[model samples]
Target: MSIEVNNESGYAVDEAEFAALARHVLDAMHVHPQTDLAIMLVGTDVMSELHVQWMDEPGPTDVLSFPMDELRPGRPGDVTPAGLLGDVVLCPEVAARQARDAGHSTAEELLLLTTHGILHLLGYDHAEPEEEKEMFALQRQLLLTFLATR
Candidate 1:
């Protein structure tokens, strides 16, 4: 898998570490070995614009996912899978602020956002309470497992 991370926000972040987190998220979801992902650590300005334009919210979000593949048309066993996932835009600045509020390091917060975004690429959604529970539980488990090995 190719996990490309671009730090375009001019923030002091460790690209290699974030890349590892991204890879771990993809692996946790059983994405194809050849799957490619591009991650951008953007500033609040960019994130705010995206939030307003795409989601109709007016604040910077920690992360946003844009999946390239469409949902399978039928039952899982009856349809072919599309191997291409899409891009994830992460705001490290927003993540850092959230981290401060959540009482964790920025790295930990980024890992959470990474897993959440990758899960979205894998057709996971958190629009409801049960869905949020399942998605967040998996994300937390995977992130904890990844951190445990490091």
Candidate 2:
């Protein structure tokens, strides 16, 4: 897989770690090895604009996903084909505040948000209660497993 991370949030972030987390999530989902992914960290103003434009929300959000190929998770034996997965946009400023409330480091919160965003790219959602349960469970599992390997 080809994962790229661009940090324009005006905050210092470990770009390599975001790439690694994305890779881990995609690999665990059996996505194609040649699939391309982009992770962008933007400022609150940019995020707020995107939120209103895309989601029609009013404020900045922690993360947003724009899927290019609309690829779904693949089984172990049937991996996804090579394609552009999508872009996972993150707001470090919002994540930092959420991190403080959640009692964790900004990096950890960003990692979780990154995982959540990638899952969205893979067609996972939490709009419904059942969907929320399943998605959150899988998100937690993926995040914990990835952290374990690190």
Candidate 3:
């Protein structure tokens, strides 16, 4: 698994552990070994800017996923070897707040966001009622299954 991670925040974040966890999550979802994923850990300032620029929101969010392509149901019978899954931008400050609210560690919160972002890259959307139910259900299921092994 080739994961290109960028920690833009000043906070001391765990790089190796998070990378391993991300790889584990993608592997659990049956992503290709060559699938390219990039993650950026940013501060609230950058997150706010991104939220406005990308999502047209005015505040920071815990996570944002920018998927390059609509994920199909399965790998094609004759598929190309190369794949770019796109990026997931995570804000540590927001994650910390959410962690406290959820009564979990910051790392755990980030893990949840990471998995959530991956699901988005896989064409999972929680916008509509049915979509929200299916997307969140799969997210919870994946998180539970992957975390149980660790």
Task: Name the best candidate (by lDDT).
Answer: 2
TM-score of each: 0.88, 0.98, 0.88
Record all residue pairs in model 3 with backbone atoms less than 3 Å apart, i.e. clashing.
none
Model 3: how far residue 34 lies from native, Å:
0.5
Runs in model 1 lying further than 4 Å from the true structure:
71-82
- Model 3 alpha-carbon miss at residue 132, Å: 1.4
Tell how far residue 139 is off in model 1, in angstroms.
0.4
Worst 10 residues of 3 by lDDT: 72-81
Q: Which stretches of candidate 2 lie over 4 Å from their true place?
A: none
Question: Which should have the higher lDDT, number 1 or number 2?
Answer: 2
Task: Show the lowest summed lDDT stretch of 10 residues, model 1.
Answer: 71-80
lDDT winner between 2 and 3, please give it: 2
Candidate 2 lDDT at 8 equals 92
> Which of the numbered candidates is closest to the native, going by highest TM-score?
2
Per-residue lDDT tens digits of candidate 1, residues 1-150?
778888888878778877888777666555656677778889999999999999999999999998887432224234334356778899989989999999999888887888788778778889999999998898889888888978
